[model samples]
Target: MPRFGGPEVLELDRHHPDPVPGPDQVVVRVHAASLNHLDLAVREGIPTLKLTLPHILGCDAAGDIAEVGSDVTDVEVGDRVVVNPGVSCGRCEYCLRGEDSECVEYKILGEHLPGTYAEKVAVPARNVLKIPTDMDFPQAAAVPLAFMTAWRMLITRAKVRPGEDVLILGAGSGVSTAAIQVAKLAGCTVFTTSSSDAKLEKAKALGADVLVNYKAMPWSKAIWELTGKRGVDVVVDHVGEATFKDSVRSLRKGGRVVVPGATTGALLELDARYLFWRQLSVLGSTMANQREFEEVMKLVFMGRLKPVVDRVFPLEQARQAHEYLGRGEQFGKVVLAIDTPD
Candidate 1:
C-alpha cells in the first residue's frame, strides 16, 4: 500500500520492479495469493509494526519457481510450489529446535517483508514446498497460513485429542474454517459460534457437531448447556476482547484455549477465578514449523483435510477483495488470481 489507511489506499503497480532472489532464496511467479486479517491490520498500520511505503500485502501464495538462487539444487525453474510465509534465521536456537515461529528474527510474508501480492515474490529456498498435482493454485494458496496456524494451535499447542469437545469461536473466518476441520480430524466433537445462522450451517457442514448463532442466544451458555453443563475440553478463541471471557466460561476444568490471532480487539478482560479454579490453559500459537506444515499439507494432499476458497478475484481487484474480507462476509479464504507475466 502507498500509505496505510482504508482499502482505497491499495493501488495496482504493474511496472513495479521484479524481485531478485537472495543467496538462499528463490523468486516465485505467484499464480495465486490469499488474503488474511493480518493484511488489513498491516494496511491500517499496526502500532508496533513499521513498514516501508508501498509494501505489498499477502501472506499465502502458490506459484511456479521462476528463478532459484545459485546455491539451490533441490528445485528447478517451472516447478509448481506453495510458499511458507514464515521466515526465520536458521541459526537461531528456536530454529535449531524446529520452532521457527519462535526464532529471534522470525517474520511473516506481507508483514515484515515484501509479500506475494504481485507477479513475483522472493522467499527462502527452504520455504517452498511442492503441491499436489491435483490441487489448483487458489486451493494451494489457501493452505499455508490458515491450515498451518490451525494445526499448530490444535495439534501442537492445545494437544487436543479424540472424543474431546473443541469450541472454535467465529464460524466464518479463514482460521476458524480451518480449525473446524482440524479439530474434527483430531476426532474432537467441534462446537462453533457465528452471528449468522447461514454461517453456522456452513460450519456444521465442515464437521462441526454443534453450531450456535450468537445472535440468537448467549454462546457460552449455549455451549455449556449443549455439553450437559460440563463445558468443552478445548476452546479455539482468536476473537480477543469480544469473546475471550465467554470462551473461558465455556471450557471444562483443565481445558485449554488455543489462540492463533486476535481479530476483534487485543485488550482482554476475564475473571481470574475461572482460570485458576478451573486450571484452564490459554496457549498462544503462531504459524506452524516446517514439520507441522508438512504434516498438515500431507493431510490436505491426501484429501483428509481441504482448503475452503470462498471467492476468487483478479489481482487488480484487490481493493474489492480487501473490502469484502474487512466486512467479515467470507466463509473461507478469498484468493487473488495473478496474471502471468509476459
Candidate 2:
C-alpha cells in the first residue's frame, strides 16, 4: 500500500522491485499468498507499527524457490516451499532457546518487513520449509500464519490436552478455523461461536463438538448452559474487546485463555474478580518458532489437519480481496493467487 488507509489504498505496482536474497536468504517466486486480519490492521495503520510507505502487505505464502543465496544449502532452486512469517534475530537469547517469537527483534512478514504480496519475496533460509508435492500452492499458502499462531497458542502456550473443553470464539477466522482442528486433533471437545448458522455448521464439520450462534443468544450463557454450568477448560479468544469479557465468563476455574491476535480491538474489559477468584491464566502468543512451525506443517502435510480456504482472488484483485475480507464474511482463509512466469 502506498499509504495506510483502506482497501482503496492497495494499488498494483507493476514496477515494484524484484527481491534479491541476502547471503543466508532465498528469493521465492510466490505462487499464492493468504490474507490475515493483520493485513487489514497494517493496511489501515497501527499506531505503534510505523511502516516505510509503499509497503507490501501479505504474511503467509507458498511458492517455488527462484533463487538461493550462497549460504543457503538445504533448499535449491525450483523447490516447492512455504515461508514461515516470523523472523527473529538468531543471536537473541529467546531465539537461541527456540522461542523465536519472544525475541527482542522479532518481526513478521508484511509487518516489520517487505512481504509476499509481490511475485518475489526474500526470506531467511531457516524460514523456508519444503512442502509436499501433493500440496498445492494456495493450500500451502493458507497454512503458515494461521496454523502456526494457533499451534503455539493451543499446544505451546495453553498446553491443551485430551478431554479438555476448548471454546474458540469466532469460527470464521483463519486462526480459529485452524484452532478447531488442532483442538480436535489433541482430543479436546471443541465449542465455537459464530454469528452465521452456515458457518457454525462448517465449524461442526471441522470437529467442533458444540456450536453456538452468538447472534441468536449470548454466547457465554450458551456455553455455560452447554457445558452444564461447569464452563470450558480453555477459551481461545482473538476477538478482543468485543468478546474478551464473555470469553473470561465462559472459562471454568483455573481455565486458560489464549490470545494470538485481537481482530476487534485491543483494549479489553474483564472482571478482575474472575481472574483472582477463579485463578484463570491468560496467555499471549504470536507466530510460532522454527520448530513449532515445522511441527504444525508436518501435521498439515500428513493431512491430520487441513487449511480452510474460503475464496481465491488473483493477485491483481488484491483491493477487492481486501474489501471482501474487511466485510468479515469469509468462513476461512482468503487467498491471492499470483501468476508466476513460465
Candidate 3:
C-alpha cells in the first residue's frame, strides 16, 4: 500500500489479518483471478480512473467464502462465487432503469475500489454470484468481465439477430473470444481477425465462421468482399485508433458498432459525413447490467458459452502475467491462481 505508479508500484506485503466484512459484504479467500487490458491500463495510471495509491488491480476473480456479514443470507461461508466487479450506486437514474453500467457513480472492482489480486478480498454481497459445484475457480473467474461485456454489446446494445453477419475486430482478446462464441450461439455469422494464424484458427474452433488475418489483409476491405460487399450488420471494435476508421467502413449502411474499450489509443479521427451518409449507428458499451450478467453467466455455467484461458499464473507472479499480456500475443484470457481453502 505504498507506491502509485507502474507495475513496480504493486508491491506485496502483509497489512493485517483477514479483512472484516461490511454490513452488506462478504470476505472471501480468493482462489483464482483473470487479467484484462484494463488491469494494464490501471497499472500504467489512467488519469480518469483516479485511483488511490497502492490500489489492487484485478477485475475478475472467483473463490470460496471465508466469512459473511451479519446481514447477509443469500450465501454462506464456504460458498464458491464469482465476483461481478461492476459497482454502481443503487439509486442513480441509470440504475433505476436497470442500466447499472451507466450509473452516475459507476465504478468497478480493482479500479475505483480495491481489487481481488491479493489472497483475500471483501466485496459487497450483491457482487458475488454463486457458481455451480462442478465449475473450477479458473473457469468461474473468466466469466464476469468478458461474458458480461459481450452480452451487453451483442444482446443489449446491438440487438444482434440470427443469420446476421457480425465482425469482431480483435480475435485474441477475452471479450473478442466471448463475442465469437456468443454471436455464434445467437445464430449469427461470426467473423474474427487476429494477427497470428494460430489464434485465428483458435477463433475458428470457437465458432468463428470466417477468420481475417489483419497482418495479412492490412485493412477490412477484404471483409467487405467476404460479405459480398454488403458489409456486416455489426462490428465489435475495441482496437481503437488502429481499426476505428476501417470498422466504420466494414459496416453496412445503418450498421451498428459497439465499443467497450480502446486498447490501442482512445483518440481517433471520425468522419461525421459517413455517420449521416450511411445512417450508421455508433454505440458505446461497457460491462453489463445485473440481469445481463445473470443471463450470460447461465450460458457459461451450462457449457453453452466457453471461456478460452491462455494461461494461469500464481498470485505472486502478477508482474510476469502483466508482461505476458503486454506482448499482446495471448489468444484468450490469462489467469492467476490464488491458493485458498477448497
Candidate 4:
C-alpha cells in the first residue's frame, strides 16, 4: 500500500510498471495473493520497518510464470507455480544445514522486499513451486505463509507427538486453522479457541478435537479441565501478551509452547515459576525454510491438508480487503484476485 498507517492508506497505482526478472529471479503473472497478519503489521508500520513509501502488500502468491530469468533453469515460462515468500542467503551456515529461515540474511516477501499485490512480481527462482494442474490459484495463494508458519511451529518447534494434546489459540485466524489440521494430522488431540461459535464449529470440521470459546470461559482453565488437570503436551500461540501467561499455565511438565507471532502485543509478563518448575520450553518461530514449506504443501496438494480461504477480493478492492482482515472476521485467509491488465 502507498504510505503506512491504516487501510485508508492503501492506494491502487494503475501506473505501476510490470517487474522484469533479475538474473536469478523470475517474473510471475500473479493470479492470487493471500493476506496475513504480517500485512497488517507492515501497513501500520512496525517500528523497525523502514519502507520506501509506496509499497505493495501481500506475502503468499500463486500464479503462472510470465518470464524466466536468464540464469534460471528449473522452471520455465508458462509454469503454474506458488511462490515461497522466504528469501535467504544460500551461503550462510544456517542455509547450508537446510535451515534457510535461520540464515543471517533471511527475510520474507511483502516484508523486506517488494511483494505480490500486483498482477506481476519478480522473486527468486528457488522460491517458486510447481502446482498441480487441479489446484486453483486462490487455493495455492492461501497455502504459503499460514501453512508454512504453522508447519514449523507444530511439527518442528513443538515436536507434537501422536496422541498428544495441542492447544491452538485463536481458531478463526489462518495460522490457527492450519495448526488445528496439522496437529490433527500428526494424531494429536487438537484444542482450539475462538470468540465466535461459528468459527469454533468450522474448527471442528477441520478436525479440532476440543473447541472452547474464550469469551464464555477462560480457555486455559477450560483446557486444563478438559485434559483432567494434566495440561496439554503442547500449546501453539500467536497471541503474545493476552495469552502467553495462560498458555504456560495450560502446558504439562516438559511441554513446549511454540509461537509464530504476537498479534495482540509482544510484551509479555511470563511467570518464571511456570517455566522452570514445569520444565516448559518456549520456542519462537517464523516462516518456514524451503524444505518445510515443500513438505507441508505436499499435504495441501494431496488434499490431506486443505487451505481455508475465507474470502477473495479483486485487486481494486484491496482497501476493503485490508479492512475486513483488520476486523478479524475471517475464519481463514483473505485473498486478492489479481485481475489481468488489458
Best by lDDT: 2
Model 4 segments more than 4 A misplaced: none
Tens-place lDDT per residue, model 4, 156-252, is 8888899998999999999998989999999999999999999999999999989899898889889889989999999888989898989989999
User: Per-prediction RMSD in angstroms?
Assistant: 0.8, 0.8, 1.4, 0.9
Which pairs clash in the backbone of model 3?
none
Per residue, candidate 1 scores C-alpha lDDT tens digits across 210-260 of 889878889999998998999999999888988888898888999998878
lDDT comparison, 3 vs 4, better candidate? 4
Residue 28 error, candidate 1, Å:
0.5
Return the TM-score for candidate 3, rounded to 2 decimals: 0.97
Ordered by TM-score, highest first, the candidates read 2, 1, 4, 3
When 1 and 3 are scored with TM-score, the better candidate is 1
Q: Per-residue alpha-carbon lDDT of model 3 for 186-269, expressed as tens digits?
A: 999999987789998999999999988877776587898998888999999998998899999999999998888999999866
Q: Give model 1's TM-score versus the native structure.
A: 0.99
TM-score of each: 0.99, 0.99, 0.97, 0.98
lDDT of 2 at 165: 98
Question: Which segments of model 1 are wrong by more than 4 Å?
Answer: none
Candidate 4, poorest ten consecutive residues by summed lDDT:
49-58
Cα error of candidate 3 at position 322, Å: 0.1
